[model samples]
Target: MKFIEEVVVEEFLPTFRSMLAGELRERGLTQSEVAELLGISQSAVSKYAHGDVDINDAVADDERVRETVERLADGLETGDMSRVQALVEAEILIRKLERGDLLANLHEAAFPPLSDHEGPLDIHDPEGDLRTTERVLSSVRRGVRTLENTSGFAALIPAVGSNLVEALPDADGIDDVAAIPGRILDIKGQATVPGDPEFGVSEHVASVLLAARAAGSDARAALNVRYDEDVVAKLDAAGYETVEFDAEADVESAIAEALESNPQPDVLYQTGGFGIEPVVYLLGADAGVVVGTVRDLV
Candidate 1:
């Protein structure tokens, strides 16, 4: 079974790199400068300069590829895009092309049997639902890492433990959210992540985020931490808009009521109910921002 990465390395990389090299040269960059910008050796740049590398005409002629190359060249020349950012853009484009697009066509041309498959392959679709889920998972991972590394963050874990969660941009159900496989806990005074982040792994925090979204909040990420007067004070001190919901009632309804006035609160807290642990949720545009706010609490 051949992997798609092999095709990327053998076919896509050379062609794209050659095209980028040519674009940079046309933008008045020297060979050495192009090599540095593209992270290739000078001799490799020389080869690309001389047309010694074969580029797939399909990829080379793609408008998307051409636009990306031109944009990257302009950005690199004008110092607007870092090499890392350029690389990320290229990688994103490559993933898009790999999903039954240009690269998939090339792959089918190389292996005739793949074209006989039942339906379109979406393994690398950048705009696919699966990719949206993956982006949420990645956001959760970043937030979890931040919490794990923050000094004394374990102290924020409540009896039910803590969880970092993020939802797809158009999330409608719990399955569209990604969260820790198990609750994050305080183990020996250290924050401990139970396992890798995954979709459909979190129920409580995911529900809270979904409820907030249903209440007209545009937040896509949420983190639950222990609730206390001190934490509330800290959130207030940080200039975060705080809203309170009733824990005894339906969470969604209570949240909906609280949001009727504030609408976009940075913190949502609930007072204790029968056998229900009181918790505070931090919400933001993404997990990174949520985690950054959490770090400020420490």
Candidate 2:
């Protein structure tokens, strides 16, 4: 009888432990010290040290995982955040990720028979928006990484620089959206991220996203790139619905009217105005899928 929690214990735990152990070691902790800090055996820490533990790439690559491990490792080393708090933090992330999220997806993939089920969001809501905030940050980071890694994406950055953003579920204002601070700039044919993803840092993309949502679009994520007639043609050729809006008009009303003909557009663009730079906005269910669609263009 295999349970979902069993999947967590068997699959997620090892990778998480290994990462935490490695982080501690890098901070100059001995194997015995790491084992003590992590509440694990020295043998297990040694195994982790030797790379004997197989890691889930998806989990390891998650920004939340990296952040949490570093945070906890630092706490364990210098005694900032308590171990109990660290455990609670990790547990919160796991619970959050399991609910119709990455861990749940992994669980369903591991046992195809229960593919239709995604765990409900419950248990505890410690720090009301903590989990949700982390999820959005992680999603944006993933999308930004996708754009950074994709060849030719740098050329897509608009003159004003680009920003990748994701709105929280039922987001009503700019504060509810998370985005890269400042902007992702193009430097020497490379997309350079300025800082980590944070809430309410983006005004332009977030406004557009909220406007699109207010116009009845279900998209929660949006990314902007340099506008080009060829790019629009490629998006149309790729079977994505494209719409045009007036760049100088009221952005909310402009977007609202634009989506009227094609309510669920995959792409929205505005041509250059007297001073406004031309740009294209890609919208989707989440940051990852939006980035994937952009990847298709590449």
Candidate 3:
């Protein structure tokens, strides 16, 4: 897919700049770190932070910087701060691309385009409504990258890819998923996890599971599995606590039941073609990270 440069931008620069400032603040990342990541000076990052520098000038001779900036601009157009966050993450992504720094390093990283996937809100909680849809998009992209780097599950990433496509992702679409961050699983049908049967598995389920596993939860952490009886039985046999739920179950009821009964934060995995609404329901409004699949794009 083409980058954001393909889109018209005369009226969007100010909005993008505003987004850039907020993204730096939200991530608790400093201008110094951005400078270091881009192989530049702290003053440069500070200059950009204070609107005293130009992003183009900072990385004028760097191809990677230009490419990253264009990609970030595409994300900014979504008008989602989380998209900005996703574009800025330095942990898994390369800090320096070619001679340029990551988009988050410059002013351009601040404003990613907004998207319509603004997920659902929880009624009992006031925090659910405050989250930006960009965050959900960022979380999903991070989850996908983490899954690719993990050692064991080579078999599942492709399934995750399929789920991502069916979900109509702007974050992990081929254009962005393979750029600066570069996924470990870039092939069409390679398994990230060994010996896992591919017949019954789906990409969305595998992607979420792999991402959750990478996020440092084992069987010890509270995990809620939503799937059909057969899938649940299999997971139960594998030591996962499986809850039998219809794919069409009310999202609120499912989340309340899972959370109230569990007494701890849990990694929720819904299988058997469950939709995206449940993901939004469970992750809620103040989600730090969430990974799940939908049979159809929301």
Clash total of candidate 3: 29
The true-versus-predicted C-alpha distance at residue 52 of model 2, in Å, is 44
Candidate 2 local lDDT, 1-298, one digit each (tens): 4566877887889999999999999999999888877788999999999999989898888898889888898988998877789899999989888766678767777777554222343213544354566778899998888888999888889989999999989689998899999999999999999988888889999999999999989999999998999999999999999999999999999999998987889999999799999999999999998888878778
Per residue, candidate 1 scores C-alpha lDDT tens digits across 12-108 of 8899999999989988899999989988999999999999998878888899999999998899999999999999999999888888788877777
Off by over 4 Å in 2: 1-123, 126-128
Candidate 1 collision pairs: none
lDDT of 2: 0.87
Candidate 3's TM-score reads 0.25
TM-score of predicted structure 2: 0.59
Worst 10-residue stretch by lDDT in candidate 2?
A: 115-124
Clashing pairs in 2: none
| Whole-model lDDT values for every prediction | 0.87, 0.87, 0.34
Model 3, 1-298: lDDT tens per residue? 3232322132223333433443543456566644433444676556556666433443344454334444554454344534536446422233232112233233133333222212332212233331323333444445445444444334333222223211112223222111112223436444232221111123333333333333332311111223334433443454433333334555335434554545333335454353343321122111122222211111
- Candidate 1 stretches with Cα past 4 Å from truth are 1-125
For each candidate, what TM-score against the reference? Answer: 0.63, 0.59, 0.25
What lDDT score is found at residue 211 in candidate 1? 92
Cα shift from native, residue 198, model 3 (Å):
28
